[model samples]
Structure formats: structure tokens, C-alpha cells
Target: MNDAIHSSKAPEPVGLYPHARRVGNLLFLSGVGPRQRGSRDIPGVTLNAQGEIVDYDIATQCRSVFDNVRNILEECGSSWERLVDVTVFLTNMKADFKTYNAIYADYFRDNQPARTTVEVLSLPTPIAIELKCIATID
Candidate 1:
């Protein structure tokens, strides 16, 4: 049976969807961003009055997004080491890829999951990075 998963410790999803869903032994996580839990602030991001991104630190955002993904996994009876696949979205690939890649290597040094990084025009929020993950769950 499949079950929807929610995490009080993770940031609330910006849309109408659960944080993750478990089917059998696999957990599917929705797109996770760098926003803080219970707050609209995106780490390392500065938004002007127009709600447009003024400046952002890719290193900070990468770490935050990884932590956010880890929180969702652990909250749903999974873990970072259990992750089997990861899909990364970046709004600025040329500008941020190097920094993001370095931080990602630091986080996934022990458990290197299959990853696909893509450049997107934007995201649902004013954040630069997002992650979608899949993990094995007991």
C-alpha cells in the first residue's frame, strides 16, 4: 500500500502535495527547496520588495537544500544514505554549478546516489536550488 508522508520538521510544501509518498519500500520526495521550515526565507537568498531575487549564495543554498532533503527523508522513515536517486534543479547553472557541485560532493561523499542536475529558468519560489529524491525505506 502507498502512504502519504508529512514532516513537521521539514519546510511545508509550497503546493498541494505531500512531502513524500511511500510505496512498498520506496519513498518518493517532491521537489525540495532551500526555504526554512515554517518560514518563507530562502537561505543565502535576498529578495527585494518586488519579491525578485537580488543576490544568493549557491554554497549556502546547496547545503540548505541537502539538509531539507535529509530532513524529509528521515522524517519519513528513510535517511540520506538510503537515497538512490537525486534530481537537482538550478536556476543559474553556469554561475552556480561549481559551488553547488563542491558542496554536493561534501554532503554525498559517503553515499553517492545517482544524480541529474539541470538548469531551469526558475522555480515556484525565489530560490536558486531544488532537489527531488527517491530512497529505499523499510
Candidate 2:
């Protein structure tokens, strides 16, 4: 594995994992939450009963998550278009999938990277979504 890369513009990692790790030309990004910059805790407004944030009315949270992802990707000399695969984890699979896809479509408008989305029992803080991606740099 190549040295891990981090982004100051993104939220500080809450656990032992680095923000992202690069090996050769491939970057493996840890699952990213919707925590805003400089805040260790996720914004409490949009979450559901299962601790997953409600993504329906909140475009900002979605944007923040993508921004965090972009920051990490850029730190490793890549971008959203370079993403080859993504796995999205959500607390409520049924309600939020469409909204998530609508917002996500704005980001991956062109490349349409391979992706999988799963609804899990729970997450770190009941946040709405967590995303992990594999990307190629150059």
C-alpha cells in the first residue's frame, strides 16, 4: 500500500482509519459520513429513527458528503470522474435511495461509475449515509 493521504478540508476522521489510502495508481477511500468541515459530530437534524440521516429535504448534507469525498480524491490526485467503483451504505434503504441517487447523479453525471448501495442495521452515529469508493489517479 502507498502512503495514506488526508484532506484538511474534509471532516477529521472519527476512527483509526485514515481518510484515504493510495497504492500504485489506485486510491481506496474509507466510508465517508456527512459531517461538515471542522466538526467531528454529524449534524443532528436530518437523521432517521435508525440513526440514518433523512436525505430527502437536505441537499446540503448530500453535498457535504460528496465534498468530503472529493477532497479526499483530490488529495490523491484524482476526482469523481476517476472513480471506478463505489459502495453506499444507508440506514434506511427504501426512503432515501431515490433522493440519494438524484443528488449522486449530479456528481457522477458523466462517468456513471460502478456502484452498490446497501441498507445496514446501523452506522457509527446514525448518520444518513456512508460512502466508500475506489478511484484511479491518472
Best prediction by TM-score? 1
| Model 1 lDDT per residue over 1-138, tens place | 699988898888888999999999999999999998989888999999999999999899998889989999988889999999999999999999999998999999999999999999999999999999999999
**Clashing pairs counted in every model:** 0, 5
User: Candidate 1 has which clashing residue pairs, if any?
Assistant: none
What candidate 2 gets wrong by more than 4 Å, as runs, is 40-58
Poorly placed runs, candidate 1 (over 4 Å)? none
Cα displacement (angstroms), candidate 2, residue 49, comes to 15
Span of ten consecutive residues with least summed lDDT in model 1 = 6-15
**Per-prediction TM-score:** 0.98, 0.85
lDDT of 2 by residue, 61-101 (tens): 57778888888888778998899999998777787788888
